[model samples]
Target: MTQQHGETAEVRRDDGELIGMLRQVTDGGWVPCAVFGLPLATPRSAEAARGFLLDHGLGYLADRWEAREGGEWVTVQIVEARPGEVTVSYADYGHPKLFNERRTLQEPSPDDLRRA
Candidate 1:
């Protein structure tokens, strides 16, 4: 994808992982957030997404991931992250209930990298 001035792109790893490559607007620099994997199915709701992260023992505080919708992937900002728990808000899934609900993935598990 072409790099846009105000926008960034991320690749969703096969195992329903959230990976981010953030570009700073002021400095035009790129930084990579370590990849995080969700143990549960693709979260259909916000709450489920949060729970999956927490259960997986991935870093919770200030951790973020991307979510897919309508063939487009968008960023899901983690408002709360802690051991055994995570909470996120999506740019699109705005309904509090639907937004707060967890989702399931349509396909099977994909390959993923394990951190050392």
Candidate 2:
């Protein structure tokens, strides 16, 4: 996201959907592509950037997700998944009904892993 300066690499999902492009900045740091509203990590090497994306890529959208609402963690449904912007709705373990909320994808709440 930083001004797009440096070498670039294309990262894709298993299904060949573009996750995002890694941008190497002037500081010799590699920035991984963003997915599902997740934060962009600036890694020191392109290898690290690619590894991070391959491990936690767009596939995350298919997994169950939870969100904090009013200080309580509740299961939510991902209504939409896109780079930098994601929409979620409060789920009742059935169909999601309620306000569609736009979240920064800044928080990840999985069973054993936490991501930013």
Candidate 3:
């Protein structure tokens, strides 16, 4: 896929949390990208991009996630989430002491994982 590039503007929460960013696409329209730079939607006007990200927020991360590990996908619990970093712990399925921590630069969105 061709990479999209443009001037960037950061959107932040009231508490100064970096929420997302608005990136200008080739057509001079803005695209709303998630905290870790995942494009969330089609190109829109600058104002629209900001509104989209604010409305989307971080609520989606509350759901369970599967992280790609060792050529396989494993269930993981999000220990912490920040703008560009996410800390996850492997889910312990009956094993009480096998907690492993992994840091991922990008946390996949629900659609990205396609959970059934």
Candidate 4:
């Protein structure tokens, strides 16, 4: 994982090495926020930054996925994550066909879909 912001140097590491680095970040830097009904990270933590890489699957924060039905790139924010299911919301806010659901958007993980 690597993060680049405003002239700051790049810090890159593999996932296996990520956990130890997360521990090095100071407590003061960790900002509390919501994630799938849990509080696990903050902006200051790189592991928190990669929190988008769901244990159950792949992708990054606010990852964009191409809709199978309409071919639109819908941005998604993971609201819930499980083995075969992932609940998400419109990271892009809304779209006519996608937002048709009245409740939280519950969908299957990309792995569950067959190759096109």
RMSD of each: 15.7, 6.6, 6.0, 13.1
Which candidate leads the pack in TM-score? 3
Q: How many pairs of residues collide in model 2? A: 0
Candidate 1 C-alpha error for residue 11, in Å: 28
| Candidate 3 local lDDT, 10-36, one digit each (tens) | 888887777777778889899887666
Clashes of each: 11, 0, 0, 0
- Best to worst by TM-score, what's the order? 3, 2, 4, 1
- TM-scores of the models, in the order given: 0.25, 0.49, 0.60, 0.30
lDDT of each: 0.37, 0.57, 0.66, 0.36
Best by lDDT: 3
Q: Please write out the lDDT profile of model 4 over residues 1-116, one tens digit for every residue.
A: 54434322122336522221122234434322222222234445444434432341232324443333345455555554442244555444567556533224333423322112
Which residue pairs collide, candidate 3?
Answer: none
Off by over 4 Å in 1: 1-61, 80-87, 91-116
Stretches of model 3 off by over 4 angstroms after superposition: 1-6, 92-100, 106-116
Task: Indicate the residue-level lDDT of 44 in model 3.
Answer: 95
Cα lDDT tens digits for candidate 2, 1-116 = 21233366667766777665576778887777555434356565877887777777666556666676555566666667664456666654432443354454533423312232
How many backbone clashes are present in model 4? 0
Top-down lDDT ranking? 3, 2, 1, 4
